[model samples]
Target: MLKRAFLPPADALVAFEAAARHESFTRAAEELHLTQGAVSKQIRHLEQRLGVALFSRVRQRVLLTDAGRLYLHEVRGALDHLHDATRQVMSFAGSQDVLNLAVLPTFGTRWLAPRLADFLRQTPQAALNISIRLRPFDFELEPFDGAIHHGDPIWAGGIVEPLFPEETIVVCSRPFRDRHLLAGPADLLRVPRLQLATRPMAWRDWFEAKGLVTDTAFQGPRFEQFGMIAEAAAHHLGVAIMPVFFVEDELASGRLVKLFDGTVEERSAYHFVYPENRALRPVVSAFRRWLTAEARSARLSRESLLPG
Candidate 1:
């Protein structure tokens, strides 16, 4: 048999959190619809359990002790998480499952957002809640069923499923390309080259792929996101290396033009990642199958578009 965990009573925790927030037992009691004495009793019980004085009682007011302040921060976070989890469950009404996902900002907007309608249509029983997360995080701490990951497949304790490899190409404003007379990769050296801060070696790799070695690969105005870099390049700031999937709108609308005929495939790829424990979940499995199929179709379409 499993040993019982040492946890304070839920009602006491709730009372303590409320009391700590307002720093007044009367105010907390009013908010919780309890008498001031009842709120004080709950807090007193909590203090006894923890073996620490939570508040410093002055003439007629109460202030959090250092320990109380620290505990309040943690308790508040736990309460907020619990509230959110409860709300999420309640919101699921009749849905079979709700998949909470963490997605990269740009990827979420450009790629995943566009395809979500299809997923919704295909899996009518499931609902999705997406939040932007720039980097990988511990699944145990975060309230997420899965995450869309880019780069290496190195999420510890996660089941990483490859979505697609990223293919990037050189792009610039029409005038920027024409003004510089960039007929080949070497011509790019004369013009300003924009850089994505995340991929420092992108230009270097592209140049090396074309049999050219230069010190200028790392030189340029760096932006944190590809969207910013693409916008800068569109305004003739400089040529930017961007994923083909991201700049379809710009390329189609004539705002940005590809400078080269070929693309540089990154060593990394996009992945659908979830904790190993979720592998057997029906919702997770359904979404994975849908996503991987979509990825495969996208890859085939891209391949067909490439020059043979």
Candidate 2:
């Protein structure tokens, strides 16, 4: 009977928990990094196997009455117990808990990956699962311990800690900048602007911040990501408003040069966001401390250069 009880795949239970917590599969999907269809299917499969309906759907929203609430109560406890047991067993081999991180793709690849060697050295035997998240996701609904997010936007239900602040500066290939005879800021008007779809208004914001609100901000070909935009700029296809932190190597190598003498803060800063409820987790707390230390160190260096 016990074996039969535990026979069902753990994924079904996970799906149910996620759905019950968020009351919206879409949000759960974002958190779990699973498709909406997949989440719903998992829940449905679990319900069929258990022979009990878990969620009561109403008008495109799910409501948890007695059954779901009770089930969640028990399931949460069970899951916690299971996790504890797993950790206890795995702890013997030092293959215990994992720290799952979801970060912006470009930032993770260009910045975080390099630092991971040091991180691993410090936290020996700790496994790190770094996943790329190009958009905002539901941390509560997902299994991520934490995430590195872009933008200076406020986090409503999660903890938002700054990893760094950034400024968007106009950059283009050296040859392109010179061949176009781009003498300064005003010269940008005659060049092609490479835009990031996520921040379609980045050019506008930067221009406005620099007191150059021209119609050109809205007239660029949009790319889905910063990496693509950067690549196009590296190839001298056009001028790109790129975050300085992301293109440091290119700039240092003189492959990509700042087009203007000035830059702008689109009010967008990078943050380390996670469930506020997760602060109690030891791994979460440790990573936060370590990350903040790095961020503060960098901030201090940047501040040292300022006329403050």
Candidate 3:
């Protein structure tokens, strides 16, 4: 026979436990909304099933026997565990499909923000939550379903889906460009060039990519965030290197002007990364499909608008 089959009925165990706590059959019946005889009969039935005397009639009150005391300890723990398990299952049922994502702060605001409405409209059933994450984080330790990684496609412990290559251009206020009398990429070395604290070698890389040599490539006022650097450049404080899409608004409004003939492609590209061994969640899959399609369409549209 199955082990569960040997267990007594839950109702009888509950009745006996109530009567044992109160030490009075009448009090137990009042709590249970039954007659005193009903509580007494349940205790008797439980005792007969277990083949042991579970209670003793003493001084017109009910007292637990040695066997009843031991059984009560185990039954109380079992019932509490069952109640907790049920509650947890119900909570999971309500929120099992919510997708949690970690993203870079600037990327989330500039690139992803404007495009998010399309994804939401396309996949209305999918619920997504985004949190700022600057660098790669441990999936085992963090409560994230996936992440937007700005660098290489190789995440140590996750699967990577390619997003796009980083295309950067030098930009500054229109007045700065005219005042400096810049003729070529080489002329930039003489002016106050801005630098990203995260990419100290950006100026040097851009210069070298144009086959120019200069010792002043590393010298500049470094800023931690791209937004701050872009703002500084827009106000004619210095010239800054920025991604094309990031400064599209500034360029369109004539606040910032792009210099040079081409963009400098960063070594690492953007990617969507997630734990390799994680079970595929419905909401996450829906988001991935929508986001990739949006990215592709945006790229094509931008390329078509560029002058040949």
Candidate 4:
């Protein structure tokens, strides 16, 4: 005996999901390489089988009904889980480790990219897939295996491995610094300070740490990402407070200069975060070992550069 109540025809469900996602039978048909009539028929059959209207037609636009919206959420999760399970089984059969990792944009570009070659060389049996993500996402719905989070390890359902604390230094174009005398931290208040939207209080924190205060610390042109701020600072638009490792290339080429003599430690630090359940995977363990070691090595290097 088979349980008909528990199983929907996979083909019909796929067609329904695609149509619901696009909200247009024509678009879904094009995506699935089927005729519009066939797509419509599948949705009609699915609605009938479920004993409800999945969608409502208002003129030419198709909108999901309340029931349809709820069903779509569950359907998407099931589909994603099935796909992940299939891939996991394939990886296991082949004895290969596949990791879907998300990274912060600027850190991925300036810091991790240069070191990934070594990671690949040391972990040849593993295949690392990288994607750019700035914030935490749901592991139950999202496909990411882990992420490099640039903040405190406070995310629920994840185990955090501390990488390194972030230390920022103020930097500006050399030409801009040459034109103005910035002999002390107080002089920084006179110039236009570029700011990061993510770190709204960066300048305030840095200034207060140096025993100075200013009203204009929060006043500046704001950028959404670190890379944009770096580019703006390099062009002499304004000064920026950024991680030393992030602006190393600009400093080496003489395009940018550090404005102060001391570094400010930020409250948040970089960390490698993964789901607690997946911590035992061989691939996860390998990456944890390699990246933790790399972060430790980098900390030593950063400490040596700062004045004793």
Give the number of the best model, judged by lDDT: 1
Of the pair 1 and 2, which is ahead by lDDT? 1
In the range 1-308, model 1's lDDT, one tens digit per residue, is 14335588889989988887787899999999999999999999899989999999986678999999999898889899899878877868888888999998888888789999999898899988888898999999888889999989999889899999999888889998888888988998878889877789888888898899898889989999888888999999999888888888888788999876777778999999999888888888988999899889887787444432
Ranking by TM-score: 4, 1, 3, 2
How many residue pairs in model 1 have overlapping backbones?
0
- Deviation (Å) of 189 in candidate 2: 0.9
Which segments of candidate 1 are over 4 A away from where they belong?
Answer: 1-90, 303-308
Write out the backbone clash pairs for model 4.
none
Off by over 4 Å in 3: 1-96, 304-308
Per-model C-alpha lDDT, please? Answer: 0.87, 0.79, 0.82, 0.86
- Output candidate 4 Cα RMSD: 4.6
Task: State the weakest 10-residue window (summed lDDT) of model 4.
Answer: 87-96
154-204: candidate 3 lDDT, tens digit per residue:
777888888888888889999999999876887888899998888888888
Q: Candidate 2, residues 1-308: lDDT per residue as tens digits?
A: 88888566888788788888889988888889999999999988877887888888998888786877888998889899899667644644655557878988888877778777876677676777776788788876677778898876666678888877786678889899889999866777788889788877777766676578697687877888778888899998999988766777788777788765555655668899988888788778878888888777765664333221
Worst 10 residues of 3 by lDDT: 87-96
Task: Compare candidates 2 and 4 on TM-score and give the better one.
Answer: 4
Model 2: pairs clashing at backbone N, Cα or C within 3 Å: none
Q: Cα RMSD (Å) per model?
A: 4.7, 11.0, 14.2, 4.6
Better of 1 and 3 by lDDT: 1
lDDT of 3 at 141: 82
